[model samples]
Target: MAINARHRLPILLAAALPIGLLLIFESKLTKGADQVAPPTSAPSPPIAPTPTFTPPSGPPTPRTPQFAPREYACSRAAVAPTLDGKLDDAAWASAPWTDDFLDIEGPARTAPRFKTRAKMLWDENNFYIAAELREPHVWATLKSHDEIVFHDNDFEVFIDPNSDTREYYEIEVNAIGTIFDLYLHRRYKEDGPAEHGWDAKGLRTAIHIDGTLNDPSDVDRAWTLEWAIPWSAFSPPVLTQPGFTEAARNAAAPQIGEEWRVNFSRVQWTTTLEGKTTTKPLTAPINDSYTQEPPKETSVTFPYQKVVGKPEDNWVWSPQWQIDMHDPRFWGRVKFVK
Candidate 1:
């Protein structure tokens, strides 16, 4: 191991060279590992916070009616009608008959096969309505009060005193004078229920059939119906809850010159008499002439009649553009006159 100084120095230099080379290689490897290549794609945008969602407060607005609503000048009655299902009284002379009813779906549909007309009058005590329906075969089946009178040929009245389309009143009466009355907080489309228990208190209705009822053998003339609804019946019950007072209720009677939303509907069915059934559909020819012969004052009979083919026809004073009678937005306007 004890060599000359020059030889020993040369060996040491070789060993140091190898070690230095190894260290250089190790340093290069570490530098390459620490270095990073440019990203192939843009760094993902910083994740954005999800936005909060909110819902509408109420139902969407309904489409406007295709046709303009009809209007009527409801005049004050000098004398209350006798409420005998007859429009012959002098009190009705001042009131004008409404235009003939058309298909509930509007003028786009065919005219009603039979003629129908109505008139209105109001007094301090009661509101009067009279309707005349020309039917070839006057018939009725359901007679129970509050029964679905529309199941039979029926006349219906809808009234919205505030014109707000809320808390409206509906009264349906059949030829037999069966009454089905209810109150609605909103339209059926708005998920409102018919409060059948709410009734038109002190309501009076009468029906006069000109032809023999339920008899298929004879061609009947028409049926006239009358209603006298007391103003007090329209007064809503007083709410006893907080923020409520007796003054919250509307006046018993409408003030002069006030306007209200109103509409009328008639439901007619296709029917045939038992044992006299025909294969042909029970549709009457369109009566071009709205005029009808006067009643003969003959005795009427109630024979069994069977409903035949298609569904009932809905004829209305104001065309709904849709078959729905519950939408007060399409109802006609009635301005109270002195």
Candidate 2:
């Protein structure tokens, strides 16, 4: 055991030197790996995008109202007779009056049949309109000219000379000698008293009753009425044309054939079996004419007649009288027959 010291020293040095070298290399590798790499994290999924929101729409605009213009309907503009000829059986054959008057109410209780006829004629001085209502019983208790004529069985007339569906006129008469003259339109509020200067100038209405009108015992036969409307109440012509104002100075203000708004309505009442007066339609017992609202399916128009020359014309509302029936503008132009 106490052998040579040189042999033991060489073995120990070789083993100890290799072990220290291995430890130093391992420590350096661990420190270098920690400094280079970052912390670990899980991968994320892709996102979907969102859409924008919008609101809904609103309502639509309204439409304009229209009406039937009674232009050519008025006999004043017609070339035939011109509504100024003398009233005789010959001229009466051609007037626009309806023979079979109608009942206003529905077809439940028909009004008694009556003979109704009308005529129109004009002269150098005035335009004339007449109507004759032949009744079975002619009894009139009311005698006032301005009172309600339809309180008893009566006949009514509506005149829209212009026939523009606006600014027309209406009149009512009963067998009892009562007369109700009124202006009409699409509205009632626009109706007012006849104008002072706006006279039907030579207008006249005569009622010839056939029987006792108001007497419950006797029956009325018939009633007649005559009217003469002058051309003075129309609006003055604007100097819109040459010689228009000058021509109107001496000549009639409204030239011949100048039509105004006009229509006729007959409100007739019947004595019911219950001894009560009822509102009857303006139709004949055989035929009903009062239920008509006019032929609206067709277009309406009015033509101006050139009396002396084609004089410049003026209307109550504007270039031409046109408006909504429900509007007040139409009634304001009521010029009454004085």
Q: After superposition, how far is residue 90 of candidate 2 from its true place, in Å?
A: 4.7
Window of ten residues with lowest summed lDDT in model 1? 21-30
- For candidate 2, the per-residue lDDT at 195 reads 21
State model 1's lDDT.
0.65
lDDT per residue as tens, model 2, 212-294: 33344544445565555554423322333432221222325333445444333344333332233322222222111111221
Clashing residue pairs, candidate 1? none
lDDT for model 2:
0.34
**What would the TM-score be for candidate 2 when compared with the true structure?**
0.44
- Could you tell me every candidate's TM-score relative to the true structure? 0.69, 0.44
